[model samples]
Target: MMEAININHFNRHKITEADIIRRILSGEKELYEILVRRNNQKLYRVIRSYLNDEAEIEDIMQNSYIKGFTKLYQFKLEASFSTWLIRIAINEALARLKEKGKLYHISERAEELNKNTILEIPDKKQLNPQDKMIHHEAKQLLEKAIDQLEPKYKIVYMMKEIEGMSLKETALALDLTLSNVKVRLHRSKEMLKDSLFVISHDTHIFEFGFSRCDRITERVMENI
Candidate 1:
């Protein structure tokens, strides 16, 4: 398949992620652009993973890249360039999150809208076809579940599930240990699964949750 060939080409590069780090360390600034371009779209998804808005995605991404470039010297080459970049992206998102404090705030508004406009929890009697759709009903529940998450856990959910950030990158981004990232990510995954499962079947939750979108997807799970 064509997909197989493309993946093969990427794998053939074999320079190893560590090689990219060395390139950055050796003053090959231009090469850093290669990494950025390769992952730029993905990095955008990563930023949106936690930040959750299209308007600010670019600002956060650019800021993250600048930070990564400035800190390129500190890169130890112990992990893939992707991992390091992810950490920078996450830290930048976290910083912006603190500044705006709108991530959770917006979610709160969404919850209110869901409660008031989206769902009525129809008492005792189920309605007809259109009413059975209950589309927003499920969404309200899912949003409520997400609303209950701590900021840190919310980041984990976004990075791990939404952006697909790997455990290593999540830990590095938060400057936490691998075990901590794993624990948090695991909890986030379970929490998400449980949250959505309440409104629908497991298969539906899995598909709806993982489907790709115009928003960025970091695939953090790949490296993990």
Candidate 2:
């Protein structure tokens, strides 16, 4: 029986992602679990930016990982594996949207589309139960506002702001120019800030918990 390996073990050994991929391609197939565990959060966030359905997002994520594994030989070692994987995930999500007729091209004028939007967050510390509730509600509101954004802008925001991916990596993943990524990110913030009196930089807005992470990893490992 294969034991579940914690990603921290990889970190402790200072094993690079390239090394893992090399080993996986060299017949150490189980090492792929390390990549899955390492990227589950980021993959979930990127896919969540496109689709709102949790089950659908998990399905797409599983398919993306399986697809990526099958195509591991084609992955360029000099490039970032996360970015490559994200590109695959994004393509999968877009294909899903296209199948449902929800995929629409947003022109360069997407920044001008949603100008009159407002999102307000109350500036309160979560010192007590009541304050915690308020904070939770505020996060939900912020997530809803993000979800309502056009796909183009929302994707940029999700990658740069929510996922904390570098500008270069985000551009590479989304196939956008650096300037375009900056522009979309700025416009996304402006769209949200127009009505957002107070902003909270909560990174845990669309958190994918440990249980779901394990489930996704197990399912993908089983299928692959």
Candidate 3:
């Protein structure tokens, strides 16, 4: 039923990094679709954690791929292609957040970490509908709660909770002291928990974009 190439019937058994590079350099621009399809879900989860707008998610993702392709020639054998691409994606997603006024308190979170600030969240159903209505609602509530956080906490939440980046990676990315990242992450999670439990009807901020993007992923997969 797939409208595209039968990936299962590819003449080649695997797509290695060298193969991808060769294809790119040989002027096979459309071949990049293989890479895009392979990485879409991974990239989506990365974007979803920090952003709620599905269309904007597509915009940012498309932007990331463009940036990655342009920078492909600069890639080295030091890191896997996917790792390098993910770094590019994360940077793009963060930049998108900044442009949308989601990033705030740009300096305070860089302060030394204290015992007072840390982010924590209880287990909650994510995109799964059957997980529990209250918990599903909690996820939406959490997004709204995040919009209210100071830039410091927001960045930490975006990096840790959404992107699942290790603390070391996050610390390096934000140029923050390790403790600072941890503390802010803790505070952000706590705030989100409190917000999600309150049951908000004004959840318009994340409703539309997320659903649409989710649909896009489904369509792409079903067709491929």
Candidate 4:
């Protein structure tokens, strides 16, 4: 019983990203699976924002993981491992977009988009859904609204709101200025508020299911 308890304790102790990177770099390549599983959901949403096709998104995901794995030695700890990984994924998605001649109309016109972008998050406590159906409907409406936003704003919003990235991290991943990230996030929130006309917060958009997660990780492991 004591030996079993020690084994359970060792397994339960979480591995930090830096530690995992070190292990993978030191020849324990299987440890890369930990990083893949940890960031799969965020990577899916980030890449999906650029490409709508499910198959293409999965392809970009697998490619991004393989790219990051090969370039792991170049990773600097100045940013979180997740942020570094997000940067790679975003670059991969944008490359795929450019190749397909569907590059977004991303401009540096923060000044133009900033106009009337100062909408408030209105009191949403009154609009809470009481049941699952209402919640699902509200979520769907919110997602449709987000889908309508410009790429610049949508990416900022996904990184900040959906993935819970810090402002600095989002800026780093998107290669936008800190001020740009803030302005675009504000505009994105306002757009959602205007489109939904009620609640402005829904945490269920662009869900990456377990099956897809396993599939992407498996492909990456096989290729790596």
Q: List the residue pairs that clash in candidate 2.
A: 118-195, 119-195, 119-196
Alpha-carbon RMSD of each model:
8.8, 3.1, 7.9, 5.7
Tens digits of lDDT, candidate 1, 1-224: 12335434545776565666676678655445445545665565466556546657766666666677777778776666667777777777777877876544544332212222333433214567665566556655655565455566666665566556677777776688888877876665555544363453222322222223212223221111
Model 4 over residues 1-224: C-alpha lDDT tens digits? 12435423434796566777887899988777777877899998888777779999999999999999999999987788888888888889888889988785543432222334433333434555555555666667566666677787878888888777889989988888999999988888776656353454455678899898878888998988
* Model 2, TM vs. native: 0.89
Instruction: Name the lDDT of candidate 4.
Output: 0.76
lDDT of 2 at 76: 96
TM-score of predicted model 3? Answer: 0.54
> lDDT values of the candidates?
0.56, 0.84, 0.60, 0.76
Candidates 1 and 3: which is better by lDDT?
Answer: 3
Angstrom error at residue 94, model 1: 2.7
TM per candidate: 0.55, 0.89, 0.54, 0.81
Show pairs that collide, candidate 1: 45-216, 164-220, 164-221, 165-220, 166-220
Q: What tens-digit string does per-residue lDDT give for candidate 3 at 1-224?
A: 22245533432578676777777767765555566666665566556555657777776777777777777788775655655776787788778778878654243433333435333433443535555565555555456556656656666676566555688767765668899888887777665544343333233323435455445544443333
**Can you write out model 2's per-residue Cα lDDT over 1-224, one digit (the tens) per residue?**
14655456776898999899999999988889889988999999999988989999999999999999999999998788889999999999999999998889553434443545444455565468877777778788778777767888888888888888899999999999999999988878876755441443567879999999999999999998
> At residue 136, what lDDT does model 2 achieve?
79
Query: How far is 168's C-alpha from truth in model 3 (Å)?
Result: 3.8
Displacement of the residue 223 alpha carbon in candidate 1, Å: 28
Worst 10-residue lDDT window for candidate 1 reads 214-223
Model 1: how far is 100 from its true place, Å?
2.5
> Would you list the rank order by lDDT, best first?
2, 4, 3, 1
Clashes of each: 5, 3, 7, 0
